[model samples]
Each structure stands twice: as C-alpha cells, then as structure tokens.
Target chain A: MKKSSGDNWDSLEKNWREKLDSHKEEVPAAIWNQIEKKLDEKKGKAVPFIIHRRQWSWAAVLLISFGVGWWQLSNPNALVDDSKMANHIQTEINAPVQHLPNTSTPELEEISSSTNPNVVSHSEPMPSHDIHSNLNQEPRNTTESIPVIEESKPNTNPVILADNRTFEKEKPASLAKEESVEMLIDIQPSQANNQEKENSYVPEPSKKRHSLFARVVKQLRQAIDGEPVDWQTLKQGDPKLENSIHQVANTYIKTEQVVQRTFQF
Target chain B: MSKTLLPFKSEQELIQACQKQDRRAQQIVYQVNAGKMMAVCKRYLGVGPDAEDALMEGFMKVFSKIDNFQGQGSFEGWIRKIMVNESLMKIRKTANRYDQDINETYDIAHPEDAIMHLGVEEIQNLILELPPGYRTIFNLYAIEGYSHIEIGDMLQISEGTSKSQLSRARQLLQSKLKELQA
Candidate 1:
C-alpha cells in the first residue's frame, strides 16, 4: 500500500497537466454575472453578522447584569437570585460601615461586611442596571483596579461554605415553587427519604396513549425507512393480497376484477 | 504582469478592502473566480444549476477561509481545494453513488495520444460534461493526480472503485472524442 516518492511526484505532475486540460472552456458571460450576484448576496448577508458577533457578547453580559439588578430591587429574598447577590457583593466590597447591616438588620449585613472580595467576585454578577455606564466616559472609576484600602488576607472560598452548610428542614406550609430558595430547600429533604428519587428529575415515562403511540410510530417508521429493500416482500392471505394482481385487467371493471358490458359505439 | 497582481488597482488593496467588508472587493473576487469555480463545481454536480449552487457555496467558503491562506502556496490552488471540497460535500448529501467496488485495472498508457489529439478547451469541456460521480472521481484522480488510495479515502469508496472510476472516466472521454470525430 506504500507508494514510492517518485510515483507520488509523477501523480502530482499528471494532475497539474489534467487541470490545465480541464480549464480550457470559456464560461458564458451571463453565468459569470449570476455567480457574481450570488457572491454579492453572500457578502451582504454575512457583513452585518461579522460586526454583530464581534460586539454582541459584551452587550449580552452587560444586559444580563442589568436584568439581575432590576430583579433584586423588587425581590425580598435577594440572595436567591445569585446574579443580583454577586453584584451587590461586588458593590459592597468597599461600602462604608454605615451601609453595612447594623444591630437593627444584623446577620446578613454583618456577613456582607465581613465577606472577602475574592469570594464575592466568584459568585454570579448581580442584575445591576447600567449603574457603571458613566465609567466608560469618565476619566476613571477603575473597577479593575481593586483599590488597596483593605489588607490582603487568606480568603476562605464561599462556594465551599455554601456546599457544606446543612439546609434548614422544609416546613410543608412554606413549600412553594415561586420561591427558588424554598424549592431548593424542599428538594433537599427528598434526597434523604427521597420522595422524588434522583431519577425523579427525569420522571418515568407514563404509559399514556399519546406517548406510547409516538414511540411505536417512531420505531415502526425507522424500521421501514432507509435500509436496502428487496424486490419481493409479501404478506400472506389477506383479501387485499388475494385479489392483488400485477397485470392490467384486460376489461375495465367499475369496482371489481370483472369489466361490465360495454355500450354500443 | 504576474508581479503586478492588481496592476491598475492591485489585488492586495482589493483583498484588504474585502477584509474591511468592502463591496468592491467582494465584486472583484466574485468576478475573478466565478468562471473557474463554476467549471470546478460543474465537475462534481449533476447539472449546471446544481453546479451553480456548489459554485456559490464554494466561493462563500473561499471568502470565509481566505484568512487561512498562508500566501506561500498558490492562492488559486488553495481556493480550488476549498471549492472542490465544498462540491464533494454537496454531492455526498444527495446520493451515496459508489456502486460495486470497481475492481478493474485501467489501460492508462499516459493518455498521450488522446492529449495530442484534443485541445485543452475540448478536454476541459469533456471533463465538465462527464456525469457527477465519474467526473468527480476523474478530476480528483486524473487532474488532481491523487492516488487511488487517497481518492478512495476522500470519496468514501474503496481503492478499487477509485481506480475503476478513473479508468471509466478516461474511457468515456476517449469514446466521446471518437464519436465527435466520426
């Protein structure tokens, strides 16, 4: 199967000779015009897309962050919306002690004040509206700067803390799909008694008529389609097959095999 | 003349303009390659209209992948390879035409006599006139001079089929020419 180098070179030379031979036709002028039109159409369609893709990702990121901020403003359980929580964490990193939750609104506010910036950055970005839009036009707000006001300390990872914590027992009365945090907590108790087992996520397909019919249809259709077909396939002894004949009936029949008497010409 | 690729306008200016999404550059590239790509595409398609479709698709691929052209290799060669690939891919989608692993030896003795008898235009036209499956294999094997092994691998057929197809293509061409002579 291994070819000699000389043979390969000879092959290349032969190909070139053939290519020269094949390109001898003068293409009609009209066809060439049509080809140009096609190219123009393609270039036109793609030009906008090239620019759009290049710019859209940044816009998408900003919009998502903005959406999160709006969602937080109305929601009481702000931490359930991870994006807004992360944005708040980033904004609050340098926030004054006055803004930090005091004895009045204590636990979360104290946690916010103490949380490390490194941990804050890793969580989802808050739905912060274009609060920082002016940063671009201004000389510098320096979001990237991470100002050296606070001394660097060994920061514990928040995700690890979140994963390790034991979730509170779900009170059946408080269980609601509308509250994501409650639903998450609700789902956890099931993992123990496992009311809905792991496979519950993809529920067992019920033997409903619609579902069974679709699966049967799909299998039958697939079985009949695409593979090689033999010329002679026949089912036995049905009346349809008993009457089925390949040859044309010499006499025309109104509905059956026999033709009725014809009228005089 | 070859060095002055753009001559009055310069191909580099046009290519750069194309990079900037210029209409004029798009027009120039289309105008320059349409005829040749059509001929290439026609070799791999069932009919002229399908060939045109392949031609359009190929040119689109050419423009998109133009950045990958290293400039060390022949520009037309690079573009031609892309166009050929596009045409072949299009052909595969429609039909799995490789029938019976063609296991026959070709009596190809350099085809010198036929080459001498036929003009380049005649030969090119003859190749374009071939049926899609045969024309494609012929072009890849004879003109591209790909080994039967390479042609088989590329077309998803056995080496024997590639060999037989090339021989069949050559035989078809010779017969067509003989008919014209008669």
Candidate 2:
C-alpha cells in the first residue's frame, strides 16, 4: 500500500531540508569589508544630519529672542514701569495751572518745540468749516513748525507723552482739566499780548470766565485739526460739562464726516 | 602595529560582546554564519553579486539588531531568517522576474531516490534553475518548512498562489531529477 499523503510529503521535504540546510557555500571575504565600510558611511552621514538639525533649532530660537528684544526697545511704552507711570500721573494731578503767555501762534510753536524735543511736528490739513473758523483765522503752522504737547514735568526734560498713544487713556480727569485750561492760556496770548504792547512783559492770569469756553472750543478744534484728544475726560466727565462738551464734539464729528466724504470722492 | 584579539568564552558572552559592538565578536560571528547564509542567498538569488550583496546586508542587519535577539530560539535560525528576507528584498527589487509564470507542468510524485543520490550543489543548482517565483516558494515551503500560509505572507501573495507556485516548482524539480537520472 502507498504511504499516507502526510508521510510522502514529509519525506520529500525532509530530504531537501537535509541536503540544503546543512550545505554551506563559501562567502567571499571581501563582502564583510564592504559591510563595515557601508556601516561607517551610514554612521558618518547620520551624526552630521542630527547636529545640523540641532544647529538650525538653536539659530531659530536666537533669532526669535533678538526680534522680541528689538520690538520692545523700539516701542517706548512696551516696557513701561508701573511705578514711574503712576508717578507721572501724580505729577500731572498736582502740577500748578500756569497762565498762557501773551504770544503769537508761531511763538507758541517755538515755545513747545523748545520745551520738548521728542515731539514730532506733523502739519495735517485742517478741514474748512464754521466750527474751525477760529483755528482757520490763525496763520497755519508749517509741518516743521507745528507744536506737539509734551508731559510738563519739573526738573526733567519735557517729553511728548501724548504722541506715545497711551497718554489719553492713562491721563486722569485732573490732567485733562489742566490741559484744557493750559490750551486756553496758550491761545489767548495772541489777543491779550497786543493789549500788553510791551514785548518784554510777561502774561498774567485775567479773572475771565469766557476763556474756559474758549479753551474747550479750541481743544475740540485742535482734535479736528488732527491733534490727539483726551476723549476719556469728555465722555466720562461730570454731567454738568456734558451738554456744552457734547455740542462742540458733535460739530467736530460732523465736520470730520464731511471731510472724510470729500476725500472719498 | 595591531592589537591582539580574544575569543568569546561562550555563545551568550559572544552575543553580549556583539551587542556592545565588539569588533572581534562581530568578525567571529560573521565567520561562523557566512557560509550557511551564502548558501541560503544562492538558493534564492543564485551565485553572483546579488547573492553576495544579500549576504553582506543580512550580516549587517544581524549585527545591528543583535541586541534584540534576546536569546529567542537559536541564533543561527534568527540569522538565517534575516538572510532569507534580505534575498527576498533583492528579488522584490527586480520584481518582474520574481513573479514570472512557469507554464510547464508535471505529475506530482516523489523523487526521494534522486534527491538522495544528488550532491548538495547539484540539488541546489536544480532548485536554482526554477523561475524566481517557483524557486522562492519551493525553498520557503520544502526546505524552510514554512506553511503555504507563511510563504504567502512572506512573498505578499495569496495562499492559493503560493500553493500553485510551490506545486509548479515541485513538478519542475521532479522532471529535472528524472532527466538527470536518465
């Protein structure tokens, strides 16, 4: 009888396994040498690629650090010291209200520019409207001759804080009242200085109430003329001043809207 | 100026040394396995640079991954599997040659006597003459003792395809054995 299927296949498989598995062919010795050289090459290539990636990572980190440092330095208020800012606000609240000197618009510009070097004078075209007629009557200052308001601190050189962009929000109500009072004092000099007649005479405070309204009006006019405004005080002040302030503010807004519409066309 | 080399005390010690990338241990391991691995490569790739290349690549893998061996089964078995896989990879690179159809067929019968009479190289040469697909399937199934399922997985073919290729290989080998016997 023929052997079972399993037995027959097993014998054949067994015979081949015995012959081939035990068999050993001679391997050229040079093949091992080739393997060693290739392994070395792979190690050589791998090390540098990892180091190169690490170097790139370090470079990226340093570049980002340098960029952040440069940005903070260029932006003056980026590293604002809270204590110094509080001190500046305190100084503005306590500072005495000085009278505007008897001087011309050019003289005011000269005084402002002489007082603060950080102030950048930029003369934007003022919109022609009834609201700004008072400002229009005055001689327009050239781009280089316009005055920027600076932080009026004693002893230290006055620096243009309003132009720093954070001045309006951080400025207290007392500071706004003082700036409005001081602006009126500055503008009244042109008319009052003529009464003085002597160029050498210094200006003194007049017991005049109309100068307050003029101060508020001129502040609104200055805002419409592209100077920065302390809108915080105007919006959030005592309700008693709101009516007069809002009426003038509305006129300024309407004039600005008309100007924008004119420019769009 | 050369340094003296010491032989490993035992197989475990030898494996540990190879794991540490000891050059002497690596050379000794290569010397022991190279002949058997070369034989396995020649069976799949035949006697040429392809066979030699597979042998070199296989040994390199064995050394590189020696730490992973973990004393699992026989070390020689582990190395032989690597050599076989390396040869298969070389076959796959040529791809077209490895899947060719051997159209000729013969009856399924035992050639136990002829296999017994033939020398090792003669039987090897006979297996080598089969098409790459047939040869690979035959070596994997008959000599390597792999199931048709295992062969299919190894060569990325279906079990049925592996069976058919193995059948064709056996028929061709039997015919060749008869021709030699005649």
Candidate 3:
C-alpha cells in the first residue's frame, strides 16, 4: 500500500488548510466591497503633495496653537483693569508720615529729661556756679536745659496710659532694663518713695532731654538733600541778583585805567 | 490604455513597470505573489494579526527591494526570501530571540506519548492556541525548516534561547493536545 497522508499525520492541519482555502475562495461580496472601498479611499486623495516653504508638521503646530490662544483670549476673565493697580500704587505712595516717638503721655517731661542723663547728672552746685559766671549766656535761651518740678496732684488718665504704652515700646536699653539700674544711675534719693515706687513709676522730672542726636540727624539730612530751594529766588527768577550786587564794582577796577586812557583828556 | 497598465504581467514587464514608478505594477506584484509570500510570512509571523501585518510589510519589502533582484535564482523564490525575511524582521521587533529552555531538563515521559492519542485537528488547534512567542519559534523551526542560528539571527534571540523555546513549544503543544483528546 502507498504511504498515505495518514490519519496519524494530524487531520487538524488538513482541516485548517481546507477552511482557509474555502475562505479564500468565498470572500463575500460585502467583504470585497469593504476592501474595494478601502483601496478606493486610499487612492481617492492621492494628490501628490506639493510642499512650499513650510514643513507640514509646523503648519499643524501653528494651527493647534492659534486655536488654543484664540479660545484663551476670548474668555471673559482674561482681561484686567490696570487703573485699579495704579490707584493701589498711588495710595501706597501717599501713605501718612508717622513719627514713632512723638506720642503724648503725662510723663512726657520726665521722659524727655531722662533721655539724656549727662546734663541732669551734672552736680547742681556746679551748674549754678557756671550759670552765675557766664554773663554772656542768657538763662532763658531756647537751647538751654530747663528744670521742671512736679506738684502733688497726681492723676491717672486713660489717654496718658495709652500714649505711654505706645512710646514705652521704643525705650532705650537702660530705661527698658531693671528699674534699680535706672534709679542708681541718676535718681536723687530724696524723691524715692518706696511706697509709691511699688506702683509703676515713669521717669522723674529732674532728667534732661538729649537734643544733640536730633541736631546731628537734621544736619546730615540737610547735607544729603542740599539746602531747600530758596523760595524767594525761585519765585522771582533772581538767581544772579546776589552775585551781581556784591561784585560789580570790584570787577571794573582793572578796566578803569584802560577806560581813562581811551576816553579821558 | 497602455499594455503595461496591467502591471507586472511578466518579470520583464515588472522590471519595466517598476522603472516607470507604476503604482499599478506594484499592486499587481503584490496581488500575484501574496499567497506564496503569506505562506513565507506565516512561517515567520505564525498565525495571527501579526501575519497580516507581516503580509503588508513583506509586500512593501518586495516592492522596495525589487531593484536588488538580480534574477539569479527563481525571482519568486528571491521574492519569497525577502517576504520571509521581512516577516522575520517584524517578528524580530516584537519578539525576544534569546532561547529559553522551558524543558532543558525535560522529564517528558516521552514527547510522542503526549501526541499519540490526539487527532491531527486537536494538535493543530493546540498549536494555534499557543502563546505568540512560542508559536512563532515553533513554526519557524519545525515547519519552515529554519536552523536555530537562522531563527535566532532573524528574531534577534540567542541560538540557545531559540532552541529552548522551540523545545518548550513542542512540549507544551503536545501536552495541550493530550489534554484536549482526553
């Protein structure tokens, strides 16, 4: 007998082959229509692409960005009024000029006096002798140190307390440290009432205010800023008037001899 | 209207049409040899969507590389090799070629013992159902007669891995067929 395509040779492969062969033979008209349509569609738009200066992908990128940017700009919340921002800046620009330590308090005299211990700590007898010897120096001059003594009617005002609290925040280190240290440095023992001292004591009136630092700060500010514009000259437009009057006669001294030779007999 | 419009009616015609950039000639070349190329593609791609991919892919190779056809051997055979190689290259892209030994130490009571009970259909179905990685290797080595090195080089796998994967595919395919027959 011939060597058969035997049953032992696996009918599974044989049947698979048959199935596929049949499928090839009998592709349905519908399937063929789909295939044809696919081919036709591919060829339908087969216009040989003509490219100019730009890349195709670049055009795609531009299209996407423009669409996105257009949508973003058209949104209602995208715009902001700049005038409001300007007004905010203007308000900040015109904010009040507040001096920190000028706040009022019942202890104002004592506080001002205590700010400088050097003047108040000088022996009173020495100051009396100097005042007597200095005949040219007036006792009541505006820059002289004045002495103040408190009378016995003490009052507690809420406004005074509030102002003291505000200015106390800016106290110098010696004033802010132990009350004993402050007392030891400059206090006259006669005014020490151990009874009233149990309560908070503001600086005593025998202290003298320090104006030297403030005077120096004023001078530095003037140096940096230059003298404030002279309002009278500015108003009159008279920049040269001072020089013209002061030097006119002096400038003609050299020319006088030449003028005499040319025009005098 | 032109006689060459039929595209690749003969090899001479194909060469002539190819020189003219005839799209129809390309199409005809594809249609004529698709079945044979598909057989080659099947050995490389195995049975699946990948085979379809390999089919289109090999056609492109056949067309693009047709210029290299020196008409040395049967052009159809040359064409078959290109399609086969194209399928393998695609498979190479998708598959790991390193030979994995599913049963390097296979204690398979016996390989024949597993397949003897099954009808051919059950076994072929088992093969069809195999994981793509194993099926591609099995088909390339057993049915298509590719050497292990050729399979490895074509699929980018080591020869040892290719041999091991085939052995495993056979064992697994046989075992599945056994289970089905019962």
Candidate 4:
C-alpha cells in the first residue's frame, strides 16, 4: 500500500471541494419554526420597556416623600410654634396707639386725678405708680394709655415676667421691689390678655415647663427604646425659640442629674 | 414559471425590508437562502438537529446584524459567512472532547470507482464520520477554500497543525472509500 504524496492529496482535496460545493440540502421546515419561535422569544424579552423593579420601587419612594413634604408645607397644624404666636401678640401690643382727638391734655389730667388717687399721692411722679393706679381705676383706659408710654420710651416699659423674676432674684431686696413694680407697669393690657388666654389654653408657665420637660424625657426614652425622632421637623421655626427650648432642655437635664446625685447620696 | 413571473423584490429591497423588521421580507429572504445555509451548516455539524440548531442561530444572527451588511458583497456570501461562523462556534463548543492526535502516515489505497459512485450525501456522511477536529479543519481548508493560515486563525491552531489535520482527514476519507469499495 502506497502513501499518498502531497500532489495526490491536492487532487483529492480539489475533488472533495467540488463535491461539497455542489451539494445542497433542504433545510428542515421545522428549523424555521424553531427560529421563528426563538425570534419571538427574543422579541418578547426585549419588548418590555418597564423600568427595573428596584428602580420603580425607588421612584415610588421618592414620589411618596415629595407628597409628604408638600402636605407638611400646606398644613396649618404643622406650623405649631407657641413662641411665635406669643411674639406676634407682643408686637401688636407694643404698636403705637392713636389717641382720640376729643381727649385733650386737660381731660387726661382730670381723668388721671379722679380715677387714680395713688398717682396724685405719689409726689415723686413714678411711672410704675401712675400705671398701677390707672390699671386699678379703669382697665380700658389703662390699655389705651400704656401704648402711649411704650411709644414714648420703649425700653422703660420692661414687662417681661421672666425677666422681672430673674432680675429680682439676682438683685438686692430694696432694688428688687422697685424694679419689680416698674416691670409690672410695663405690662400692656393686650399682652396681659394674650398671656391670660395662653394660660387658660395650657397650664400655668411652671406647670407647662414641667410638662415640656416630661415630654422631652419621654422622647429621650422613646429614642433609647429605638424609635427615631425627626429632629429636622422639630427644629423648623424661629431660632430664638429653638435656642430657648434647647436651654430649657439643658436645664431639665441638669435638674435630673442633680436629683439622681441626691438619690445616690 | 408563474412564480418567477410574479413580482419579486430585488435583493436590495428585501434587505431594506428585513432591516425595517418586516416579517414577510425576512421570511422571503429565509426561503431563498435557507437551503444553501443549511447545507453549509450540515457540512460542519453533520446531518442532524445540530445542523438545524446552527442554521437557526445563524439566521437569527443574520436578522439581528442585518444593518452591518453594507451592500459590499453578495447577500448570499454574507449570509453564508454567518452560517459558517455559527457552525464553527457550535463545533468548537461540542468538539473539544474529541481532540485526539492525528495519524500522519496512513496507508492509501485509491478506490476511484467507489469514490466516483458515492453520492454527495455519502461523501458528506463520510466527512461527518471524521473526528470533529479533522472535519472542521477539512471543511475550512478544502471545501471552504480557506488558506491554512485562515483555518489556523479561525480554529486557533497553528498553520502547520491545520495542514497536518487536512492531510489526516483526506487519508481517513480515502481509507473509508476503499473500505466501501471492498
């Protein structure tokens, strides 16, 4: 048996190429069905323009957050700053009052003398005595006159109850009484009315402060209990009020610490 | 005659319609070329469902990448190339297990009458009977007219390896022809 040479292999290769090149087979009809089915499957897979499930979830979350933010902005109940309301009332009280054209200076003097014997008796002409006498005599007229005094010298009308108490507490006994009387004279009728209304609505200031401290403690407890507080929403209003609340919170914390130390002792 | 007389779209028109994803035009293109493409796939994959799988995959690729055909070559050549590539890929994946070393020096007995009597189907079956490695190189080099260099690049074998494989394939086929004659 002879081994084929390279030339013989070339001839065989040529013959093989000619044979295979001329050959044509019918593709099975079922192949087209398979291909069409595959194409259809591919098309089905590709056609869905739906966002990913996670992306859709994220979009829904964002939409919900925006809706909640918008609702919070629109809701009047959401704007519950007690201190802002108090400041607004004080501003109204401190505003200048228009005196009636018919009420002359002589009439004012006569009214002052008749209604307020204390004012006439006070020879030194103390502003506090004049105001106190007028308050005692006629509440309506006192309301009108106080704004006049406020307009004349605004700082002299120092009617902040907290300030008076702190000032008296820190001062000598004699100076404390005089300063306390002066501070009382500074209380405009409108401010007194507002304070009364607030007092009626909530508890007295001491009780309210205690309740606030209790609420803060409860919030701290809840936070320790693993509930999250949205401090961002709580700190939305006036900076001054935020500062005062922060101070009160610190004071309450200090008082709690002192009590804790006393108990330990 | 009547089918020929019926208005048939030019190859360009069919291609354009296929690009637009027109199903009718795509079907028409498939009908025209699928037999030849199947034959090409059958050469590499042999006569079976594997050939059908390769053909189907090839056609799908054709449709998917129809935009890449820049009207430079004959559409049939473009389609034929895709079918060939698909067949090669399928063979590479399935044929890795059959990577036996080639026997270079086989005894050759020329059986001209037997070789001549064998129909194209018999020859194809004989080619399929060759080891997958030999069959692939044989198809690429001899039948497909790819240079040994091209076959090497396509199959990732060296050029000398492709030449040796082709020789081994021819010897195997000749021996098969002699056996059929005997």
Query: Which candidate leads in DockQ?
Result: 2
> Where does candidate 4 stray beyond 4 Å?
A1-4, A50-265, B1-8, B97-118
Interface DockQ of candidate 2: 0.40
Q: What lDDT tens digits, residue by residue, belong to model 2 across residues A53-98?
A: 6465445434443443444345434223322344345556645543
Between candidates 3 and 4, name the one with more favorable DockQ.
4
- lDDT at B83, model 2: 94
Candidate 2's error at A89, in angstroms?
A: 23
Candidate 2, clashing residue pairs? A100-A185
* Candidate 4 or 2, higher TM-score: 2
Residue-level lDDT of model 3, residues B144-179, one tens digit each, is: 557889977777777877867866675676577567
lDDT of 1 by residue, A175-202 (tens): 2222233223333443524543431223
Lowest lDDT block of 10, candidate 1 chain B = B108-117
Candidate 1, residues B36-146, lDDT tens digits: the string is 666777666744667767766677666666677666666667767887888888888988877758688556333333445465566667777887778888788766667
Best by TM-score: 2
Q: Let me know the TM-score candidate 4 reaches against the reference structure.
A: 0.49
TM-score of the first chain of model 2 = 0.27
Which stretches in model 2 have alpha-carbon errors above 4 Å?
A4-6, A46-61, A74-77, A80-265, B1-6, B97-107, B112-114
lDDT of each: 0.51, 0.64, 0.47, 0.63
